[model samples]
Target: MEAPPVTSMPVTGGAVNMMEYLLQGSVLDQALESLLHRLRGLSDNMDPETFTDHELVYLLKGQQGNPFILRARRSLSHPTSPWHLRYLGQPEVGDKSRHALVRNCVDVAASHSLPEFLNEMGFRMDHEFTANGHIFRKGVMKIVVSKLSRILVPGNTENTERLSLSYLVELSVLAPAGQDTVSEDMRSFAEQLKPLVHLEKIDPSKQRH
Candidate 1:
C-alpha cells in the first residue's frame, strides 16, 4: 500500500500564538541514573514513558537570509506511532528576567511518508541522529533525558556512535506567547533538580561563534 503524500499547512494561524519555553542542561553518564531517579519523584503520577527515536533535520534554502530548518522524528520502538514534524524559530531576545529561552514553534504529526514528501518539497537532509530517552511530564512542562548518537551511515540507524559521555536534559513547555509566568514555573521546577542537573536557558545562536 502506498502512503499518503504529506502536505504543509499553516501551524501558526490560530488566535492563540504558541511559543516554546525551553531550558537545557546536560549530565555526565555516571550521574544519569541519579537524575532519572530524581525526575521520577518530581514528575506526575503517570508512568515515565521511554522512547527511541530517529530524528533527521532538514534544511530548505531560499534566496535570502538563513535557511529554514525542520526536524522530522519517528519512534523506532513504536513503529505504529505517527512521525513528528517540527519547526523551531530562532530564540527570542527577551529581557534577562526570563528564566527560559522562548521561541516560536510548531509541531505536526505526519504520516510515514514524511521523508519522501519533504524531499519532494526540496528539503535537504542536514543531519541524522538517534535519541533514546525517558520522558516525564508535570502539568504542561515536559522533561526529556536522552543520549544522542551519531549515525555512522547515511541511512543506517543500526550503526551509530555515541556523541559523548553525557546525556542532554531538556525542560520545555508549549504555551501561548507572552506567558512569562510559564518561565517562572520552569525555573522553580529546575531548582528542585539542582545539584543533580542544572537546567538553564541556552541560546543556540550565541553558541555558534
Candidate 2:
C-alpha cells in the first residue's frame, strides 16, 4: 500500500510559538529517547539481586547527576553527601534540574554559539559548565528550562509536575511557609525570559516580593 504524501512544511499557526513547536518537535523526540533509557533501567530495579553493581549505578546515579532521585551514598563503603546537596533547598528545585543537561541537550544547545539568535529571542547565557574542557553557558535560561521540564514532564513525569501551564506555575521547589519565596520568585523570572528553558534564573527578584 502506498503511504500518503507528507508535507515538508514546518508546523505553523495556533498558539504556534517557536518554543511550543520545539517542545513538540524533533528536539523533543531526541529528549524522550534519553529519558526512556533512564526509566527503563529504573524499572528493572524491582529485582535488584539480578543486576550487577555497575548495572545498578547505570540505572541509579551515585552521588550526582539524576535530579528526581539522588545517590544516597557515593559508594558502598563511603557515605557523606553528593556535595551538590549543599545547594538543595527542596525537591522541586532538585527535580527541576534533574536530568537537565542529560536530556534537553540544553548543554548541547549551549554549544550552538548563537548568542544573537538566543538574544533576538530575548535569551542570554549565564550558567556555564565544561564538558571535556569546553565551556557552555545557559545563563538565566537554565531556570526556564527547568520550569518547562516541569510542565512538559518529559519522560520523568512522576517527579516533574505536568499539570497545565497555570497550575504548575504555582508549583515550585521551595518552602511554602517561609517568609521568603525565592525559588518560586526565581521560577517566575526564568519563565518570563522568553523560553530559553531552565536547568536554572534571576537572583534579585528571586525572593519574596
Candidate 3:
C-alpha cells in the first residue's frame, strides 16, 4: 500500500514539540514465536494486552491532488471508547545514518459525532480496515504485532478477509522534537529483536515509487 500523504497543521498547546519516531518491519510466520518470547523477556511487566481496532481513512480533495489524509480509528473490542483522529506529517530526515523516522503529528480524541463533523468539512471516507494485535510497552516505546484485514462490507467490521499471513511489527515512541537521543534508544531496543525481525525505518517515499 502507498504511504499516506503528509501535511502541516497548527499545533495546539504543548503538542507543538511532540514528534513521533517510528520503525516498521514484518515478522515471518516461523519467527513470530521467538519475537514474542523476546518481547516478554524485555518488557517491564509480565503480560501484554491485545487489541482489535477498525480504522477508516478519509481524504479531502484539493486542486492539485488529495491534500489531506485523515485517519479515524476506534477499538472494536471496546465499544464505549471514543474514536481517534490522527494526522502524520512528512518524515524528517537528519544525518544520513539514522534509521528511525521523525514526523510531525496531531492526535485528537473525538466524540461519536466525529464522522459527521468531518463530512461537513468536505472529507470523504476513502477506505477502511481492521487490525488485530498484541501491544507490548517498555518504558517509552510501544511494540505492536498486528495482522491487517480488509473489511468485506462497509461499517461492518466483523466480516473481513486477511490481507497477508505475515505480521506487521512496529516499534515507536512519541517525544518532543529535537530529542536526538530517542533514536539511539529506539535502535538499541530494536537490536534486541535481532534476527527474528530486523526493524528499521522504511521510507514511505521509496515505497510510493
Task: Choose 1 or 2, whichever is better by TM-score.
Answer: 1
- Model 1 earns a TM-score of 0.92
- In model 1, residue pairs whose N, Cα or C atoms come closer than 3 Å (at least 3 residues apart or on different chains), thus clashing, are none
Evaluate residue 151 in candidate 2 and report its C-alpha lDDT on the 0 to 100 scale. 18
lDDT of each: 0.88, 0.23, 0.84
Instruction: Evaluate model 2: give its lDDT.
Output: 0.23
**Model 3: per-residue Cα lDDT at residue 12:** 61
The true-structure Cα RMSD of candidate 1 reads 7.2
Q: What is the Cα-based TM-score of model 3? A: 0.89
- Tell me the tens digit of each residue's lDDT in model 1 across 82-191: 99999887676455788998777888899999999999999999999999989999999999999999999988999999999999999999997778899999999999
Order of all candidates by lDDT, from best down to worst?
1, 3, 2
User: Per-residue lDDT tens digits of candidate 2, residues 119-173?
Assistant: 4544333322111100111222211111122312222223433222310111122
- Residues 1-209 of candidate 3: C-alpha lDDT, one tens digit per residue: 32342224345654366778998899976778888888999977947789999999999998996478889999999978999999877686544565588787778899978889999999999999999988999899999999899999898998999898788999988887667688898999999888788998877878886
Error of 1 at 183 (Å): 0.5
Q: TM-score for every candidate vs. truth? A: 0.92, 0.18, 0.89
- True-structure lDDT of candidate 1: 0.88
